[model samples]
Target chain A: MDNLQTEIRQLIIDALDLEDMTAEDIDPAAPLFGDGLGLDSIDALELGVALRKRYQVRLDGDDPSVKRHFHSVNTLVELVRQHSERTA
Target chain B: MDALASGRPRLHRMTHEKPDGVTTRNTTLIESRGLTPPIAPGRMDSFSLPLAAWAAWPTHAPGCAAPTDSPPPPGAVDIAFVDPMLRRRLGPVARMALNVAHRCLGERTGVPMVFASRHGELARTLAMLHDLAAGEEVSPAAFSLSVHNAAAGVFSIARHDTAPATAIAAGDETLGMALVEARARLSEAHPQLLLVCADAPAPELYQDDITTTESAHALALLFDLHQSRRLHVARHASSGTPSNSMMSLPLADLLAGHRPDAAWSGTHARWEWTLDDA
Candidate 1:
């Protein structure tokens, strides 16, 4: 869990060009959009593309599960781990 | 303002001061309050204000030169920036509108205003053509957004600004078209008008015909002048060597670089000038 958190945090920073951010600055449970990382709707779309390209996870705009999966670094890592494990 | 001809509209030709590498031309009106919504450094997406506000959170090396003026007006305003990356993904209409809108309303919410983009949204139009080529249905959203005035619609919704909105898409004469409308609206008692004119680099298909680079430029004209201030317009050619005419410079340049003592009025199309506010 710890390792995955670190990896995902780095990915978010790299993908979004969060120039001032380091992995440690990201909170596991904090929101990504408004307060936590200060991302916006367009960032959400870019992140969606990054997730698919990196993890081979297919996302649909209509899927309600995407909300939970994208809640934060911790949730995203857990979701990625669960999906990867099931596929493996 | 006087009509030279009685019955028909008099044609006006715009003359631009040629810039070294840039091919677009524009003139702007700056009110006493500074350009409304004072654009901040690195704040690219003032129309997509979220991108601008988020980008301006003091992280990256500061982008544009710092404003010599005071801090931006307060509010949770919607803004967007035209960082090269995002600009590459947008269509011409979107590109032009976003550029102009950002210039006008980056961070402050004042009276409701109008947005004018001559080319409107060209990317959507290109996509519609591509869909027709592929025997696929043109996306309704794309079709609607393709309209010349769609940028104004998006600008309005993005800002949650319900003030009277007008969008004008006049072919090569977009600036003249929009200016006429702006003048009419002002006559009808509208206090302020935000006039924006932007055009994108010609697309690949049209490249052979029009060789302009992905030219993207916008200007904000704040028409609300205090009674003490007067805008003057007269037909005259520039006497000095034209240095920065063809290219679009940042709003700050137009505010500071031009002769402040001489009030200027000119339309962007032919880049003609009628010195006003002298």
Candidate 2:
């Protein structure tokens, strides 16, 4: 879980072009949008594409659960872990 | 010249005296290819370029050796004034344009802007086209910034400015036309206008069709109608040689005070620039 969290953090920084921030700067439990990371819809879409490409995880655009899943780095880690376990 | 009576516009007889006590009369007679007559004297307040910081640019000019070391990447562009998140989305050309425009405008805002480029965002456009051809989803950021006016639009957004902005693309005449537009805007309520011209080399697939010296470059010129320097543009017989890659190179030289006057031939006309003592 720790390794996956670090990887996801780095991925977010790189994929979103968060140039001034590092992986450690993003709090794992903090929100990823609105007031926390301040990412907007375009960034969300770009991040979704990047996450899909990297993890090969299934993501449905219309899934209401996606909003909850992307709430924080921890939630994203959990979602990815479950997806990987189910596929494995 | 009889060519003047061949149904072609004649060069208006005008003599301009340079600050250094040199007087020049442009005798090249041809049609007025673009905005003509009553060119109000305009002052160039400032200009900027990121590529000028390179130690030495790769040159194909005869008798000039290419640099031994690899050319430096585009110079440090300090756009700290802009929001970091928004800055991250800018490509090289857009970054260059914005950086120069900011430097030229300084603290001024709500002024009209004109952005000219021969091939605007060619790399981004090409990438989006390739993605489409490959049946892949095009990145929304790339698609939005790939438009010709994206630079100008981003400038307005960054400044939170409500002034009108125009984007122009006119082959080799891009800068000339942009100047004409800026000149026209000087008479409006806003006497000062910002003009930014930028271009990057076309992608390899289109390189054969496009010609430019540098891989990419951008220049911003702040023009005020009250200043003394003037630029006269008129159509000239097209030289048979293939056009150079960067149109702003000569203008850059003029702005840097290296030359009192400079002239360059474009696709359909000649541009003569001079600085005069008011």
Candidate 3:
């Protein structure tokens, strides 16, 4: 679980060109948009594509339950882990 | 800059051309009417700040004379900005466009606008391909966010603006198609139209056609009903230069050094000025 989270966190940092930030800077409880990380909608879209490719999980927009999936890097890693296990 | 002596080829130059059935020949390329933004490179960091932002945000618009220190009350119009740093990390397509829209508004409040991106959400596209290859489940949020009009829609959100917007992709003729829609919108109620054309570098797999990587920039035009300056659009007979090649002549050739004794000729749009002050 720690390894997966580390890998995903690095992916986000590299993918978004977080410039001055390290994965450590991204709090698991912090929001992705607005004051938390200042990512706009485009970032969300690009991040979405990255997650799909790396985890083999398809994110569905119509599912309101998906909100919890992106609540933070921690939440995302957990979701990906659970889904990957279920599918396996 | 040397006239003909030290000529280095420009990466891209717009040329004029006349296709069959395209009769118009004398149209102006761009209208430089509004409070002209300074050409200085350092100050205007965000390629995409709105007119009010240009007028109001002295720290952003380079060389702008500071507005009298009083803060002006907000109005119906709003400005949206996307700086190059964000673009390099995020998506360059929309960032290029938002730049032109920012310039077109100049000092006035720009009307609600529609922005078009021929290749939208490029970063997402690449990431999606990577995910597929890895056999991982794609993030649902990424898939939903990768739509073509996502940039313009995001800009609308950034400005807290509910103004109507449109996103389009029309191949190599993206600019021409965007102009057609902009003119149509002008026929409606909006007094000024902010039309932007933006495209990022093609991902390696898709590079066979869209060959630009240095970021084809955007040109924003503020359309005014009573404004004196006007750019008439027309197709011109080709100067024999191939359409696929970028500009054949350097801008320095046009500025003062190589001012053509006669009319300048190319395969793209040209700017012609007619002011009463003359």
- Candidate 1 per-residue lDDT, tens place, B1-278, comes to 54433432333332234222111223222121211222222221100000011111111221122323111221112245433322323454454455446555556554444555544556558777997999754554455556766666566656666666766554433444444445444522445556655554444666564322333444445554232233222112223333222122322233333444322222222223222232
Measured by DockQ, the strongest candidate is 2
Interface RMSD of 1: 8.2
* TM-score, per-candidate, Cα-based: 0.50, 0.74, 0.52
**CAPRI class of candidate 2:** acceptable
Residues B145-192, candidate 3, lDDT per residue (tens digit)?
Answer: 577766666555445556677776555435444554564455325655
- Per-residue CA lDDT of model 2 for B1-278, tens digit only, reads 56445755555543232222112344222135443322323311211111111111122221132212222243455667777778887877777678778877888877788889888888889998999999877887787789999988888888999889999877776787676555444553666678888766666788576554544556777766555554443334444354454567666666666687666665445565655443
**What is every candidate's alpha-carbon RMSD to the true fold?**
13.9, 8.5, 14.2
Whose lDDT is greatest here?
2
Supply DockQ values for each candidate: 0.04, 0.47, 0.21
What is model 2's interface RMSD? Answer: 1.2
Q: Comparing 2 and 3 by TM-score, which wins?
A: 2
> Candidate 3 chain B TM?
0.53
Q: Among all windows of ten consecutive residues in candidate 1 chain B, which has the lowest summed lDDT?
A: B45-54
Off by over 4 Å in 2: A56-64, A85-88, B1-75, B237-245
Ranking by DockQ: 2, 3, 1
Candidate 2 steric clashes:
2
Tens digits of per-residue lDDT, candidate 1, A1-79, equal: 7888898899887766565579999998899877677676756776776677678777788999888788898888887
